[model samples]
Target chain A: MHVKKLRKNTFFSLKGVMLAGIGSLALSAGANAGTVRVTVAEYSAKTGPYFEQVAKDFEAANPGIKIQFEVVPWDNLLQKLTTDISANANADLSIIGTRWLVDFVEQGIAEPLDSYLTPEVKGRFIETFLTPSVMNGKTYGLPIAASARAMYYNKDLFQKAGISEPPKTWAELEANAKKITALGNGVYGFGLQGKEVETDVYFYYGMWSFGGDIVKDGKSGLDSKAAIEAASLYKRLIDEGATQPGVTSYAREDVQNLFKQGKVGMMMTAPFLANQIRDEAPNLKYGVAPIPKGPSGDQGTYGVTDSVIMFQNSKNKAEAFKFLDFLFQPKQRIKFTVNEGFLPVTKAEAEDKYFAENADLKVFTSLLPIARFAPVIAGWEEVADVTTSALQRIYLGNGQIEPTLKDAASKANAILKK
Target chain B: MTAKRVVAPYVLILPSFVLAALIVIWPVNELAQIASHSVNRFGQLRDFVGMANFRALLDDPNFIASLWRTGIWTLGVVGGAIICSVPVALVLNEDFYGRDLARVIVMLPWAVSLTMTAIVWRWALSGESGMLNSALIEFGIIDSNIQWLAEASTAFPMQILIGILVTIPFTVTIILGGLSSIPDDLYEAAALEGAGRWEQFRHITLPLIAPFLNIALVLNTIYVFNSFPIIWAMTQGGPANSTDILVTYLYKVGFRLGKLGEASAVSLVMFGILLIFTLIYVRLTTARGARA
Candidate 1:
């Protein structure tokens, strides 16, 4: 009750402060200081205060410019942006998924940042983070945060199964999984994400590790040799009892839950799982490693990034760029990333001593160099669903590996053609 | 005075007409306009594509398959609902201990949203950790857990059962209301004629409840055909689109694929199909009523 009351009081005080700030701005209307309207997908309630503080700092530094924030909840950000795009009512600056950068560019909804960015600013970002938003030789967005996938294995389970080290190759991984399963009492070797959002991405960890991609030469890559091998690995795991039965029903969260409970020996997930494991299952001993390499010794992980984008129709381009420049400065970047629990998107932030000492983030930060992102093509989301369904068919259906993947490839090709 | 009379009726229904226009007619009109164009991922209208969108849907294999799946879904839900509810409604209509409590308990599934129901069932039917699996294992019904929503064979049937679960209470309440309105004198007369329980049910109860049953069938069929959240929240039309109905496929095409024009075409086709079914169903039942 006290906490709730304290929160309410804090909220009211914040409101009063904002109202007072607006009143002062209105009173000095003739000063010619302009406000850049900003909208960010609020990472949490704490983010609102941080943004307000940043706005105050920015205004203090630049007396002729002010920042106005319109914080949106993560769930409503995409929908709200779409509505705003159709009506030409978007805020001057907003953060959007890097996966969406291409579609937004194609629709002329996002303004290209090439003209506004200095060469020094362009060189500041980690090169891989900028690659997703670059289309046809034009950069349309700046990376704000990123996530990279890694393999999480139960150290206790490994020791119990007599494994001295985490698997470093696909063959070793499979053998280790079988060994772990052999010691099972309501335990599984691996927690495979068979269903839910980004089910395809889990499969892609293997596919890309084998040096394959979902798109190759502007067509579906599902039928490629690497992809087929990737699908076959999961099928074998399911058949050999190396993975839990009903692998097809497990989402990423479900797999994480199983792993945290020490019911699964291994899982490939992003770095966020480290925080979850620390808080939820402190007793469970675990190790993080780079994903097992595929047959050709190829290794990769999916890199998910969110970028700051400016709408083409915004009138406050100069002011929005000023805010973007300020936000991307090394000091501000570190603060934003630390609060957001995201991997740094800038080289300076990546090399920071704070990250080097953080053992949980060090594994992922090291893996950032080899991480690949989903293709930023239009209709990529639908194509991902097709791949997910195909993987489900292989795991849960009759386990016909080749034909199902080929069929999915054909379907994806058709979608891409549209 | 005639003008005043006409104006009075218009004024009385003006609010309803405006609401209808805003909610229904306007969106339908927009959908129709979009159906004839090439809409990009961001929903900006491109050049007019005429009937190409509809033609593409007609030729699309997934869309064609979902049509039959949708039919089976609609039929399964409506048939299962009627079968399950008639007995419950009959039992509820009787004088019993805690009859009011029984009615409310029987209708409880209708109170929860379909999305919540799906979420609960997803947990219950999960293979690794599920209450249903635990019970089945305890009873020695199966040696292992079933991935209920992962396989097509189980996913389709489980979705239908979920559809029935959600629709059954609505069916029961409507049928119960119809049962309540039935005059007891006819049942008493049938009993006086030396009729058995089945004879009374067949001769009096069945015929009297035909209109209500018809209403339930049409409404349930429509609801089942257009159901989205249950299927989406559970399986998302996975396992190679085996559980996909028209509505879920339409959702994928429109929202995920960002082909609003094609999705609008699918919507028009669905609308036309539902309209025809409702018309035929109502006409046939009403014709039987007139004959009776």
Candidate 2:
């Protein structure tokens, strides 16, 4: 009888605990009714504070609607988004790599913004930056950030090497590289990035200059003559010690560090390097120029943009669209672009004195005409991985160049087929 | 037994059983379901495609290479850790000067997070402006700096060394516990019998600690096999993926490549491999123990 009474008491407590849990959950749900949650990717240390301030301002201007921001690192944004989406716990809005926008659209995860967009808001974005996010006659994302690549050369290194001007052609670049390398005290001529993310894009500068496209006529162009020639040129640079020793070890950031330390003569990168150099190494003398031309004089630069997208499953569509409208206003856009050192995506932001008067940004703006955006397709990340690994093999001398390029081309073709 | 007693024990265990089912069994069931179906990159299920995901993994050369490399990584770290820890444990087992401080010093690596350790090592192993390169040059070891993570030949070995380093603290703790459980009288008795130090260690210490050693071996194998941070943070299985093990490959497939179906299949294969290993290892050790 005593044991039975104890069991009865236990059951009552368990029931009471569950009731408390349900009560708290319902209370939290009531509090979350008008919250607009946004997942912002952290580009640098300033990104979080900038977005937090924006959220506070939005909340103050529009009462009864709360704003919540989840700041994520750039490297882990996709993984976080993937898991969040699969678990059905994602935020209402997120910033995503425009290159990955194709997969998002195809999977029906991204909501089309055509219905929400007003003509004035639609006309604010530059066409080149805005076009990458449009699909199936609908705009699914808005370009939040955009950047273009340019060549950065150390002015001190150039003067020491007795070169009066930046190289205009590949041949001259090689000669200048050799001269700079000869002045060695643990110094390298060119800061070649043969490792992580954009390793293939680094090779693409040469491939494009040699008139090769990443994909042509519904197939990979990795095995084309122009690609082969581009690979050979980079290989010769590695062989002749014009680049840093062990090129396979240096990623984009590593090479940038070398450039900042004045240990490397030149490298091709985006305009943010100018911002980094100004802050990290103020005394270092550097100049920005166009990527050197190929033997036939064709040249190209990589243009990249990241987009802010709304999830199709969001319940607070009206509130989210209001926040999006406020985010793209010229005042907010100019502050964000200037703080993060990104090229302006909106016309009003571009006309700001900070962008129009900057000489370094001018070189990037001029190269906009010939810039190539990443091709819009499904499974682009897989294809980029294939190309990066193949380039690594070539850089490490683990495989012969021609056959390796052929093998990679065939592999990329298979992914493209899927 | 009485019905009341049997029923009472089960009732006491019911809550724990439910918790285990919620955390473990449910996820495995989900994975199995996803693995057997054609899934979109976002993990939404499409038509059922039995065994297609597994077959795809079998055909990929990178997957095969990573499988073999996982074997080497597990063996290298676990074997090397046991070998190194035994001696350190034996030394600390002796009542010497500042033994407490010494044990804490040995356990320092375990106090820090594995990812932080790996990141520090990456900076130290960098080709230029790295501490390791600068120290080597200072000591007149080589006239030039070596790019430690530039290729698989050097990078893989260094990674294994790091794995052993981080793994030493746990192994030593287990071995020390085993050593303490050993009675001091045995060594004294052996010494009285004219047995040497090595002989005492061989006959008495080794036999008594065999069970603890087995426990360490099994636990370390499980931990090291699934260890992700050291390799992922250092090389990310790169320089043409020469250093990729199973976990890193799974991350790339599941997250980077966004092939959830194939990634699920890869994880199932990994689970199968580890399960078989643990089962066989436990069986062999228990069988030996029974015989003795």
Candidate 3:
């Protein structure tokens, strides 16, 4: 008898959802004029006004092109896209994370781009942007934006702590943080993401800056002195209270929230944050600088690329590729990046006066020449997952770095074996 | 009489059976097949390693951890539901003013969409600006914001708390239905006897509702065991895979890692485990009744 009531409720709720979801789709279908669909993370509201303007600019310039942008949350995007693609129901053009390149190729869900690339586009964009797509000699997506981690400092906080400028070395950064933290009013000098959702980003950048590589020679190289030093440094910071106490529990969003509230001395963040800094806290004085150097003068950070890929199932391939080609043009690329607070991938765009004028914008584009791309293997997501979890365990002092990474490497190797 | 009417029953049932097979039986059978074979993302042939998938699952260290976590989830969610609902349902069953309003408040979580519930809880548990954290810190009992969903050791407990909050409405409604069925005469007879309330409840009320209770408990356990959204929203089984249950592992294998075969094997194991548990529950309840 109780089950009957539940069944009634569930059925009615499902009916309501189906009605609303389908109704919205139908309403849009009637009004949309050749929508060029794209997907991005949900916090994209920072760039929303710019994109709306960009769409109008494109429509006015080209005529008869409409944009149907779907801002998706990072969570559940994989499942949602897979279901749509498997049903042959994908959008014409999609903004895909570089990590999706291999799976999209293996699934035959994305189109190869060699035939469509103009000589201009073929040469203008930096080679690094295309590296993820050229798996087994197949090109699938065009780079939309590239970002590498850079340290942003609270200029006012630095002065109050008697610091002159942003730290240029790891040691200096730590010292400044300690000084700033000594002020103490629910304020910590440095902030970073230490949560599980971002284990790789938090650990990998520090490891790489110290000249450590997790994998080499088809084996785990995590036992290197550089890797140990990196882990120890991260551990030392937490132990010394050079960072917020909640660093162990923080995510990127959490850090961003605190930073916007002017609660930290320095943070390593990507480019899109400039817009948030502009929009939410314009008075918050901050300076963007390259991540501090390691002892060996190695200064580096993680560079993630977001791209646009035409699905194999897209019926409007002809129109879509033309639009994509238009996007490849340098001026449009610069506009897209500027509007989105992303760094353009094209070499010419990187050298444009536009970047020269905005020093903050230039930092990311400047890193393109030397920044490292994550391993583009077919099972990289799994590898990333295992490596990240192991690294997290190490960072928390659960185990030695070498043994933890070795365990993760073996598990990842098994995943990548086929 | 010669209309060949014998085929009509089978013919009439054909569409429903076909739909059921397509929606339910086929996916289950395919999971079994996927557990045996290997395929690339495009469904292309790769390799067939038969029960190697099962072997990998058996050998996986994390699988054991996930199973243990699932056990905790099952016990906590089911136990919490009983503790919350039994007393509330008893009180609500009394002739009280605004009884409907009180019941609605108790059942509110059930009415909210799972997605909305996850979002609200995630914010309520956020390390910064989370309502619970602010309230606790403001009270001066806690000096700092509790990273409720951040650490591995704390992750499962936090999820269990959320599950307890969510389970209240469903279980209370079930118990309310059971309560309504009890005759007033039973309680009146117990009152006439020299028995107090606790003795009366054990001797009369509990025995009468035991079957319904069993049904609710078994269902709740199964539902909680397979729950995904709460953890997915709160931590994505994170802090360090501390809150990972079998479902999350299955997702990682099938979707993230593309180890479809291994994921299927995990799913099959889950199915088998649930089947055994349900059978045991059914047998025990029936045996008790038979002895009675």
**Per-residue accuracy of model 2 over A1-418 as CA lDDT, tens digit each:** 0001111222232233234334334433543568988887777767889998899989999897888887666666677788777766777889999999999998889999999999999999999999989998999999999999999999999999999999999898899998999998978888899887788999999999999999998799999999999999999999988898888888788888899999999999888888888899999999999999998989999999999999999888889989999999998999898878889899999899999999999999999999998899788888889999999999899989999999999999998998
Candidate 3 versus the native: TM-score?
0.86
Tell me which residue pairs clash in candidate 1.
none
- TM-score (chain B only), all candidates: 0.91, 0.93, 0.89
Model 1, B121-238: lDDT tens digits are 8778877788888999999999887878767788889889989889989999899989999999999988999999999999899989978998898888888888887787677787
lDDT of 3: 0.73
Displacement of residue A391 (Cα, Å) in model 2 is: 0.5
Model 1: DockQ vs. true structure: 0.26
Weakest 10 consecutive residues of candidate 1 chain A by summed lDDT: A1-10
lDDT per residue as tens, model 3, A1-418: 0001112222233333235345335534643346666554433434456556656766677777676665444443454465445334456777767877877887778888888887876788788776766767867888877777677889889889999988888888889989998988867788867764445666766777788775665655455667678778877887788887756567676677788888888888888778778988999999898888888888667777877888886666766777777667776778766666776688878788877688887776666565777766677777778876776676566777667766776786676675
- Give TM per candidate: 0.86, 0.94, 0.86
lDDT of 2: 0.88
Off by over 4 Å in 3: A1-43, A46-71, A85-92, A106-109, A123-132, A135-138, A312-316, A329-335, A346-354, A413-418, B1-20, B42-45, B281-292
Chain B TM-score, structure 3? 0.89
Candidate that would win on TM-score:
2
Stretches > 4 Å off in candidate 1: A1-80, A87-91, A115-124, A315-336, A347-354, A397-399, A413-418, B1-23, B285-292
Per-residue accuracy of model 2 over B1-292 as CA lDDT, tens digit each? 6999979999999999999999878978899899999988777889899999999999989899999999999999999999999999999999999999999999999998777788788889989888999999999998898999999999999999999999999999999999999999989999999999899989999988888888889999999999888888788899888999999999899888998999999888988998899889978987987997
